[model samples]
Target chain A: MSAPTLPDLSGHFGRYGGRFVPEALVRALDELDAAYRTAKTDPEFQAQFKDLLLNYAGTPSLLYRAERLSARLGAEILLKREDLNHTGAHKVRNVLGQALLAKRMGKPRVIAETGAGQHGVASATAAALLDLECVVYMGETDTERQALNVARMRMLGATVVPVTNGSRTLKDALNEALRDWVASVDTTHYLLGTAAGPHPFPEIVRDFVGGIGIEARQQCLDQLGRLPDAVAACVGGGSNAIGIFHAFVPDESVQLYGFEAGGDGVATGRHAASITGGSSGVLHGARTYVLQDEDGQTVESHSISAGLDYPGVGPEHAWLHDTGRAEYEPVTDAEAMAAFQLLCRTEGIIPAIESAHALAGAARIVPALREELGRTPTIVVNLSGRGDKDVHTAGAYFGILDPVETLVPGENS
Target chain B: MSIAEIFAKARAEERALLIGCMPAGFPTVDDSIESMIAMHEAGCDVIEVELPYSDPVMDGPVIQKASDIALGRGVRTRDTLRIIEAVAGAGATVVLMTYWNPIEKYGVNAFARDLAAAGATGMITPDLIPDEAAEWIAASDEHRIDRTFLVSPSSTDERIAMTVAQCRGFVYATALMGVTGARTSVSSQAPDLVERVRHANPDMPVGVGLGVGNGAQAAEVAGFADGVIVGSALIRCVLDAPDRATGLSRLRALSAELAEGVRNPAK
Candidate 1:
């Protein structure tokens, strides 16, 4: 087979990604496509983007060898410290790139859809820096659950609209954002937060965040004197995973792994493992692996990490899985939480629950790699975010936080 | 009869056709069928049965609520086919308005066959554009069902021409760049979009949807387009009713008023 070149002019990854949005957004998409194509090769645009990533968002995040944690797993592990970015996550890279593009396109307003408000906060940060008007659509349930992040977004001078439709979650927020974009496409830019959604977005986001892999590849060579046997990252719409995986796609020798959130467990029928447990369909303007019922209606996904609770995976991840270029596995909440606690105790790193899935998957693959490689395996795991935002949930899970009287019924506690 | 024949009849009467839209199995399967039949009996020239899906991105709150009620009642895709058959049996031209996923999940060709078998004349897809409709185009052709793709006020002239060429029944022109909902006044952009569609293909029939609520709004839309498509306002009659009898009575009254509005175009 020929080398995997993706998203032909139509924005398809094999058969996974394409525009499935309303006709009203087509012109805007086309204009975006044109601008992105031009900006991709423009030296001035590249210079500005690189400057923002390096000076503002702080790119080239450290690639630290986790010797203490590596000893426990019996494998050499390197952690890509995306957690150290200015916004406390890899999402800052994407928002900055899109916000810059919005400025270039002369769109003064930027709108975004967020789940746990990580992306919303990042977008607001970039908007504040760029002097753009920012509005974020968040699920009403998420606003209540992640009230701290909501307040942070507001403090950044962004308006947060609570969406109350459908399941009242991330998907609803995405739907509401699309609704807003339809009416405001001329003056506003939808700064989509992930490497998902219609054509151009999957490609654009991957390109913006592709620096993760580009940096990691060089770091691995410099530190280990060889490429790691495998690379792993958590997949929620697969932005960070794709970010770290893109540069490895052509390497062919390196293995790429994506760990999805298994809320209860995949067997329990309540996980966010779209590739492992769902079928091919369209949602949020992209055709990908979606957790849907037999009748094709989207089935709500469950994950302890609100960021990974989306029902659909990015189209590029679906394509990668289909081609066997990457491996995906579900890491149950219990297993992820175990990894979370282990990382804090052993390495003094409190990783985000979303990134804990990747850490857990790294542990799970140690024995398999040992058997396959006939020696100790070197693995690079993308620690995509910090645990600061997840302190409340983790505290509640460990029964360490005070059980407040205001806790709603059926809340995690 | 075909959607074209229905439009031809309305054209002969020197009036635009009024197409009434209702979600299948809203409230319940039986009541939804009864409601559609009542609309036809009152004055609607055609019935558009919407299949309720979990994620309706283009729908406004009213239709979304109705779809949720239908899905909550366990109305499945197969039930929608049955509803279409019943509504068509009542002697009104019937079509389906749906997002693309359910049909893709059902298998595109299989859905076209089943829709044709159920007496649906065509499908109006809000999300499926001509650029990504190769499979649907072929399936619709093989099953001989009309494919009505939408052209929006934001659609470029080239895009409008491309979208209208794939359409078989009639070209749907979204009046504004917004989701479906009833408004106090029809958008002024509707007339311009209709004019653009006519320029794209003079022979192709044009239907205008979005933001049209009462008879006056319908009459204003009928003045320029070939068909006046009303969804949210029609569904709202049943949605806000106090009881089943009241819902049906209100639906009949609105249907008649909208029907009368189409008969006497403002033009």
Candidate 2:
């Protein structure tokens, strides 16, 4: 079979992705599209990107065999450890590439919208490294939830602006960031966090983050001597999943699963399962599956993981689901939390609640797979980030810290 | 009457047209309609009724806050149409300003039919452009509804020409490279952009928006452009008012001041 290619010249992934932004952003997007085209072919740009990945962000993250998880689930489970990367998530990979591209485009300032604050921290890290002025727009609620990451971004010299608009979450932050970009397009590059947004952004982010899939594909072959039966990743805006899913798209024998955050459950109408439970509509400059009411007004999505608390997914993910190239399912908050705690106890690896959704999804499918296959199947779950930032939330949810104890962490202990 | 007729009438009077914008159901549905009617009676030549969206990415903080209030109060597409119907019934040229998603969900043809039937003469889609607006273009043409497309300062000559060709009424010239808001100074790029749009299509009346606040700023924009569009400032007037009656009165006062400024450009 030939190689898998997507998002045609106009940035349509089978009618899913298009530039649905305002006229003010058209020229900037066009310029970005042209610059990315040039940068993609330029060997110097590629060399610089590779060097950063190797020495700075630390690419080729390990694919470890989760033996305990496999033994318990009756399937061979492998953990693609993206949590080990700089900034403790897969976000750094894309931020660095975009930061370098910004430099090449003669942009001196970088801005991004972050939800869980991982992308904000990662973008701030990239900006500090590149010496570009950085600003991050985060939802006010997110700043309160993910305080550590907010502090980390500020420490890295980024101005963290809290957005208190609609929903006060990722979607709202995205809106504010786009507003900033419209005003500052002359000197500021919007370091979009996910494989979403208008033309060139989805494609550009996917290419940069596709390193996860590229490295994982080779590492799986080297470690297991064969490809996994299925690869699962959590999907919010779907950057991390798309990152690892792109390289495997051409490999027809492999199955791809995207786990969306089911805040309560799809039936409860309080979930972020855009692909699973959403209808196709436009949001954040792309025509994708969005959680909207019958009138096309975007509905608020709830999730324990701030990163996955979005009403929309990447357009490519929508195309992938429509074309039957990939399957998307929801992992409820309870199920994801269980998997989060289980991974901590069994594998000694605490994952971001976002990544735990993938774990929960794999757990849900494994029992059925064992019954159907009559043999152990190999599964690789993308552990997209470490859980240090989520420890406070987890402690609260589990009631591990009392009210007085929570007041002072190290001091009380 | 068509948007061209409005501009032509303004030109005949030797004054740039003053276009007032306010979101539907802002503060409240009926109150918003009453406020817009008051502005129209005071001096607004054309009233642009904004269909408040869930995510208004193109709007500044003031408009965003107004839209949030509207949406929070349960304003929908049908309510916006109702507001437009009331405003148009009061003998003012009405145009609907909306983001694309709601229309896409509401069905382009259905929205066009409803908008036209409600007495709205035109539409200003902030997010939808000529390149990706084939559905809207066809629907608007079928309904004989004027379609106004935005042209930014950063637009290339080719882009300007393309947008001008698709525009049925005046081309919306975004005064600055930013989201919609009132500003102290008209962007230096506004005149150049208006010139570029004129060069592309001299017949197309150019309306400059996105930063015209008070009368002086309106006069500055009106000096070069055929129409002066005001939105955030009008919303702010109502937002800062002590009561609904005062808000409507303030909206009328601001509209009258801007209307006078458009007629008499500052030298």
Candidate 3:
């Protein structure tokens, strides 16, 4: 309808985003830009994607309300079941679209970067299903921390290259992936995982992911007859938030809160709250706020959660912050860990560390929200993924020991 | 001879010099640092310090990844100044190839003050237009941070003359329609773009940028301009390393290769 209430060609979300990638990827991204336009209008491609999401990947994931957890937090908490997606995260939504588009373009291989290994796994999963070659760049340290994911990716037929440059994290992995794309501009499609990166990508990612918010928005309206007081999601590169936020930007009544991971704590110099801590500047091909230092060299960032450990945020998130359409808040690792454990013990649902930041933020806001309204307000947390993968780390954090070591398995006391 | 004197000699002896762009932060901030240092040791005519930004719209992914790591390292404008200081401290004449935001953040007077303090000789803000550049030009002129600007083949005659008039150091001539990276073949008619700038200002040095990634590219570009700006290629040599030492070793060899290419253009 009115330009689809979507991003312009420059990748603007209202007044943000534009193509800022290298000139090499221009042809490919343009190919993508043109292809996606036709695909959006093409009944065949749309039908194919719909069927894949439905029969192959399982669409319309559940929205579960946690009564006990909500009672503990003194607020109504609803979980948007993105965890139940085919690959176990909302990132699949973006990769599926990008990979399918690559196949359409007759590209042979898909190259992507991973931080928490979720995006890599998701990309690998999609590539495997589509029978395309996949290459994933993961920071060396991330490979160690996410061994299971590393193995999973290898098993799924994706080559995991451990990036050993600079802090050896997701940002470096991105650097490695970009280098590969620059070298292989002729053949490969760099399947950017989030609503970040240069031009076209931010907008493209938003449109594909806007599926989440669109579905959630309509689903929420039908269920409650009105919009919730606030919509919250953890912001790493802000794919999910933008996905959900884009649909609700017109609805000013629905407050949007983005929770950035404050690893350890904000004051500890080991957090990933780029907006809260970073200044507005040029980075990753767009002018946006990033975590930078005095000399303008991007500072190395740290966060307990692998997904939210990125230094630079999505460009649209920067615009949302500047325009005051959405506000960003930082949640600490301890707080997130507490929420992870709380969700597990109280509701028997272990939330992803990335999603735990949102729950923790919700807990902090619940009291104030309750005090202001004098009644509980409906809060939708995009439980981005399940914490099944984070069990080892969570166990160590909660002082949970090896029970087998403590007691003999064969002898009865 | 000093790097400045060597560049000056190249201008006198070779008819022009080929100043390379190995931005202070690429591959890794440390590798970026090592690349610049190794280039200095290998004798880059003049080094361009690119103040890395998150949104490097004009850069290719090679430079983008390099800048990304520096940005990831929390490397900022101050870090670049220190790098300028490091090179200047080594008595190498340094030029900056950067965007405008860091200048805004650092403030005009202070930015000039710091650049002068760091011993920077010139600058080329790729994103700035001549008309809007007067403010920084004034400040840079005051501190002697020569306000060098960029000119593409598509630039009009009037724009060329105006850019030549406004330019302080050398005019940065872009070789291609795109960013700083290594490419297989630069446009065939690249000399026409160089000739356009050389037509207006024969006195000033014109260094060609964009898509010059190898020694051959550097040597090839020299035939077109006063000097060649070889950046992403030198950095690309060390892009694959497990540690700083390996990166430095690779960078040293690449810088030598680049310097050798600069010495002999035709072969």
Candidate 4:
């Protein structure tokens, strides 16, 4: 079969992605699509984007060989250190790209929807750097869970609005953002934070973050003289996973794996494993794998990692799963936390719980890879973010520190 | 009567039609059916039954609250069909309004077939546009049901024309560039957008929605448009009432006032 070419003009990834938004936003989507198309080929746009990635956001993040963890897991694991970026996550790359695009398009303001607040922080950072007005819509529950990130966003001169509707989580935040975008699309850009949502967004985000895969692909060729056996990344809306998987998609020898969040477990009916446990439907703006009831109402997704607690996965990941070019599995909260503690102890690396899902998934598949290869299997894992924001949650989970009571700052004081 | 026939009848009388909206199964399925019948008897020309969805992006807080109450009461997609059947049986011209996902989940063709069988004249899809509505368009045609796609103030001339061509019962004109809610004043953009839609297809009836509340606002919207669509304001009657009797009484009073407003168009 021919290599996969996706998101045809209509933004569909094999029936997985399309615009399911209101008519009020259509003109803005069209304008954005046109602007992105022009910017994609323009050398000036590329130069500006590249300059920021290299000098500001600090791209070409290190691809370190995790020998200690590899020894313990019986696999040669290479970690793509996206956590070391300026914003402590791979999300900064897409933020910077979109912020620059907003500037070029003459949109002075940007609005974003965030779940864990990492994307919100990254968006605020880029907005401050680009001198654009930024407003973030964060779920009320998330604002309490990730309070530090909220403060960080405020410090960057971004106004963070707490969304209180429907499940009070990521999906609600997304809905509120769309509502804002409808009224403000003329002067503001919806700087979507993932490789999901309508057409152009999935493609745009993948293109902006695809550098993770490009850099790692060359690093592997230089260090090991060949491609690794597998590439692993955590999939929420699947931005980081798609970021790392896009370049390796055509490399028939490299296996792509996306690890989704299994909150309690898939069997418990409370997990965020959209691709693994959900069915096909539309959410946010795209048709993808969604956790929904028989009546087509969206079901709330649960995950210890707030970033992965979304009911929908990116459309491309859904397409990839259907095409059998990639494999997805659920990493339960217990298993992810175990891998998280293990990484900190064995490798002295504190990974975001979202990224720990990748490490745990790699560990789960190592034995199978060993049996198949009859030798040490080389794997590249995308450490999508750092654990600085998750320290409190992790500490409480391990009983090292008492869980802090959530404070809304000005309320009930 | 069909939506087109109702529009024609209202036009012959030289007045716009008043369309009142409520979520199916708000509080409960049977209560919602009673609410629609009451609104119709009080003088709403058309009843727009919104299927309560979990994520209603286009709805403002008031409608969202009502929909949440409906979903919390276990209102399913099939329940919406039953509500539609009951409301239509009350001699009201009924239309179903929804986001695309529920219909997609119910199977587009199956939903179209069921909705037609249930006596809904057409569907008003706030989210689904003609650009991405091939499956729905085909299904709606095969089932002989009308499809109402919205045109917004932000819609370009080409897009408005394209969206108008795909519409059947009537073309919906979003008066403002915002979600569904009641505003203190009707949008300044509504008249211009209606004119644009008229330019696209003058013969196709245009129903203006979003931010319309109270008889005066309805009259102002009715002056220029063929239909004045009200959602959040009507749902608020039941939502804020102290009891069910109070809710129906308030609903009937408001519906009568709005009906009076539409009959006495400001134009």
Best by DockQ: 2
Please, what are the lDDT tens digits per residue for candidate 4 over residues A214-316?
Answer: 9999999999999999999999999999999999999999999999999999999999999999999988888999999998999999999989999999999
Docking class for model 3 is incorrect
lDDT of 3: 0.77
Indicate the worst ten consecutive residues by lDDT in candidate 2 chain A.
A404-413
Candidate 3: residue B71 lDDT (0-100):
70
Query: lDDT tens digits, residues B1-267, model 3?
Result: 333355467866674465767767565555566677677788577777888765454677677777766676667677788888877777677888777657756777899988888888877777665644567888987887777777765566777788888886677776765556777887664688778877897777677777765667667776666777777876676676677778777767766666776676653
- Tens-place lDDT digits, model 4, residues B1-267: 988898999999999999999999998999999999999999999999999999998899999999999999899999999999999988889999999999999999999999999999999998888888999999999998899999999999999999999999899999998999999999999999999999988899999999988999989999999999999999999999999999999999999999999988996
Model 1: per-residue Cα lDDT over B21-137, one tens digit each: 999999899999999999999998889999998888888999999999999999999999999998888887999999999989999999999999999999999889998899999
Q: Candidate 3's residue-wise lDDT over A1-413, tens digit each?
A: 23245455556655445544443355556667888888888888778887887787676767677799888977778778888888888888888888888888888899999987999999999999899899999999999999999999999999999987667888878877876775565578889998887777888888878777887888788887888788889999899888877888888777788999888777777889989888875556555777876645566777778888888888888878877888899999999998888888898888889999999998888877777778888888888888878878888888785675566688886
The alpha-carbon lDDT assigned to residue A215 of candidate 1 equals 99
lDDT for B79 (candidate 2): 93
Tens digits of per-residue lDDT, candidate 1, A56-105, equal: 98889999999899999999999999999999999999999999999999
Please, what is the whole-model Cα lDDT of each candidate in the order they appear?
A: 0.94, 0.92, 0.77, 0.94
Better of 2 and 3 by TM-score: 2
Residue A145, model 1: Cα distance from true site in angstroms: 0.2
TM-scores of chain B alone in all candidate structures, in the order given? 0.99, 0.98, 0.91, 0.99
For model 3 chain A, the run of ten residues with the poorest summed lDDT: A15-24
Model 2: residues with Cα > 4 Å off, grouped in runs: A1-3, A403-413
